[model samples]
Target: MNIEIIEIPKIEDYRGNIAVIENDVVPFEIKRVYYLFDVPSNAKRGGHAHKELFQLLLPLSGSFDVVLHDGENQQKITLNKPDKGLLIKPKTWRELDNFSSGAVCLVISSDVFKEEDYIRDFNEFLEYIR
Candidate 1:
């Protein structure tokens, strides 16, 4: 499992900063965009793996932690800055947790939502990877 944290191009001025993300920023082309917000501190999301879907996660507001597993190896990464994006590859099991108050999670996906592409069970994900 190779995860990359990319720094998005940011333009700063007296007012605020703007981050720009184009099609070429990630290895996979973006086909879907979604965001998670207004989550409670004890709430968690994303406990699954995709067969062919790739995702890029950005912390637009506060912060959160993502745990990635590839059946043999695992890693935990924290996203706390708006200027960075976490690239999650296919076949990697992921779990989102430890969300702070008012945290907003922005996601860019390589494909649209497909129920058949998702492996929701941890045991199933492990077997599929093997």
Candidate 2:
């Protein structure tokens, strides 16, 4: 998997820390944003890949592991710092695991919600990306 680590600048003030993800930050424009929080114990998520949209995943609260698989290769990323994010290009299968209790996983997507844009099957994703 061609995983790229994106270092996000944290803007900290008296109130709290703030991080912004604009269009020009990465290669793709932002069109959708969603966050995963209050996950149960031992629960895994995100077993899919986008066909076109790029994704930037950030752990806002605790820590989690992102497992990236590209057919013949696989990589695991342990994300704990809030000041950094992972930039995942299109056509890579990702799985979220080892989520700490009450951890928040924020996702910034490059496109709006489209069911047909996702490759749910690992073999299908491998074939489609190839």
Candidate 3:
């Protein structure tokens, strides 16, 4: 329910188009940047929730489905556009699946990677939120 779709700024041109993410665009000072690629179609990614981290996922190429749950509500969002981003807030569980061929998911994080910050169990996540 706290998920948000962010529209990245784009510069159109005859040659090509450019999408940029400035400091003001992402709503946080990015601490780490990463991406998911070369994922098998049958396989899935992201089966956890962060306690205090914020992330924005962008489909840089191809497409994929993002399943999000905020304890009481659940939603599935398909990411297929490079200029559009999915904002994931804290306390929400997420899972990525249905990846098209050559799908590339770019992630912008608000905090560094910390295993302790992740809630990998769905029941734990729900209990934590409650």
Per model, how many backbone clashes are there? 0, 0, 0
Winner on TM-score between 2 and 3 is 3
lDDT of 1 by residue, 6-83 (tens): 888999988989999997777788899999999888887999999999899999999999999999999999999999
- Local accuracy of candidate 2 as per-residue lDDT tens digits, 44-93: 89999888888989999999999998777899999998878999887889
- In model 1, what is the error at residue 36, expressed in angstroms? 0.4
Q: List the residue pairs that clash in candidate 3.
A: none
lDDT of 2 at 85: 90
TM-score of 2: 0.89
User: Model 1 — TM-score against the truth?
Assistant: 0.96
Model 3, stretches more than 4 Å misplaced? none
lDDT of 2: 0.86
Give candidate 1's error at residue 66 in angstroms: 0.3
Order of candidate numbers by TM-score, starting with the best = 3, 1, 2
lDDT against true structure, model 1: 0.92
The sequence of per-residue lDDT tens digits that candidate 3 reaches over residues 33-128 is: 999999999999999999999999999999999999999998999999999999999999999999999999999999999999999999999999
Error of 1 at 5 (Å): 1.0
